[model samples]
Target: MTLVAIVLGAAVRPDGEASPTLRLRVEHAVALYHRGAVAAVCVTGGVGRHGPAEAEVAARLAMSLGVPERDVILEDRSRTTVENIAFARPLIGVHQVVLVSNRWHLPRAWVVARILGVRASVSGPRGRMSTSRTIAATLREVAALPSTVWRAWILSKRSAPKPEPRAR
Candidate 1:
């Protein structure tokens, strides 16, 4: 199965540039593309306090870094990790995916993907943040875990087929 790198959006600067975290994610995906690990890179995120969507910024970065535009798919209407993978699934058009995000986020993302029945392998960028930023992000991820799972569960239930009512 061909693998697609699903680069989850982090944040975009108000100036419409990719955040450091976002850049790291996109760069990592591009590296994977160069290494011939993935057939394409699917960048996912919606507009968040910015004009261009997060995926757009990440896609541009990937293209600038030499990943061909034709090989970059965009899912530009997702505001969360669940939405990221969910929205990108059709665009990816493959069973195998590489979920790309920060180290702290990959665990939750992997869980959510599996719960949603997405066959995924997780990968984090080789990058570092300031101590304060790392601590803040770690705390945020810890707090987000339960809600993330709950949301994924809800979405999974919604997508599941409902049984037909038995005739009396």
Candidate 2:
């Protein structure tokens, strides 16, 4: 398999540290690097209101994990799921990809990848900071599902091939 890229979702911290979720994603990317499965890693996320951009933090973490700086691609402008997929397209060339993120964000992330025409699978981190945070994130994702689906649908439509005419 030609695994070209691994996409990591950023997690923000209140104290300007990389969140646990983001760290897990970086760990996963590092594992991929060890396995030689992916040629490069794409870290996606913009700065939060209180912290540095998630993608930049992720890229730094990956480098610290022994991934070469050249192998890390940064999509440091995205603040949402849709922008994550959209912004990473030019940086990702692999047909198959492993997407890493929090479990609560998988559905939207996977949908966005599909919309972008990448064959992708999601790996989510286990553990929770608090039940309330988990519940809230899940509920918010559920509420956003319709809009996510709509965005994917629009993207797919725009990228789909035109139908040929029937023979006379």
Candidate 3:
């Protein structure tokens, strides 16, 4: 089966540079490619408060690291977790996916993948965020869990087809 790795992007720097978190995610995705576990890498995220689209930056980084150009699938329009998954679905054919993001962001990312009908597992490279930033992200994940779950449920229901009426 084809294995697609979804690498979630982080905020960019004011100089149009990738933050450490984004670099780590790109490294992780490239490592997966080197291991031959992932047939394709889907870079997901749009421009943050600064810099270019996260996916585009990530794709460039991956190419710089020797990942084949054709293997990098850019989902540059996604500005949120849900949008990432939704936008990536049509481009990725793999049901079993490996998601790459910051550790604090894994739970919500996984929820988004499930909402988009992907069976996924998550991994994060080392994080360099400050203590306060890490704590804030963790708290945000906790706060977002309820809505994420609810959205997943709603999405699943909507994707399921209706049964035909029974004849008397």
Candidate 4:
């Protein structure tokens, strides 16, 4: 099976710089690649408050960390966890994805993946964020869970084919 590391998006500063969370996700994905755990790294995100898309930033970091350009797949048009998985699915094509994000973010991401009918595993950087940031992120995850699920449900419905009208 083709294994891919899906580096989920994080905040990019307004000046187009990567936030620590974004760097962490990309580093973990690159580590997985260097260790031969995955064949490609698919970074996902569209422009947020920043000028450059999160995926674009992560893709550049992945390359700078030794992941070849060809092995970096960029899905630079998704702004949420649901859209992240949804948008990246086609580009990822028949791969078992390993979602890479901060530890606090993986649960919702996994939920989004399962709702999208994508079988995915998750990996996070071993390093820990500062306590305040961790608490804040955890709370954010808790608050975002419902909306994430709702969006995933909507996306799944939209992507699902309508059954042919029963033979008239």
TM-score of every model versus the real structure: 0.93, 0.80, 0.87, 0.93
Name the weakest run of 10 consecutive residues (lDDT summed) in model 4. 125-134
lDDT on C-alpha atoms for all candidate structures:
0.91, 0.78, 0.85, 0.90
Residue-wise lDDT of candidate 1 within 1-168, one digit each (tens)? 799999998789989899888998999999999999999999999999876999999999999999998999999999999999888987888978999999888989999999888999999986598889888988998899899999999998998779999999
lDDT string for model 4 (1-168, tens) is 889999999889877878988998898899999999999999999999876999998898999999999999999999888989999999989646899998888999999999999999989986577789889989999999998899899999999878988886
lDDT of 1: 0.91
By the lDDT metric, which is better: model 2 or model 4? 4
Report the poorest 10 consecutive residues by lDDT, candidate 3: 152-161
Which ranges in model 3 have alpha carbons more than 4 Å from their true place? 130-132, 155-168
lDDT of 2 at 164: 97
Point out where model 2 deviates above 4 Å. 156-168
Encode model 3's per-residue lDDT on 40-66: one tens digit a residue. Answer: 899988988986998988899999999
Clash count for each candidate, listed in order shown: 0, 0, 0, 0
Clashing pairs in 2: none
Model 1: pairs clashing at backbone N, Cα or C within 3 Å? none
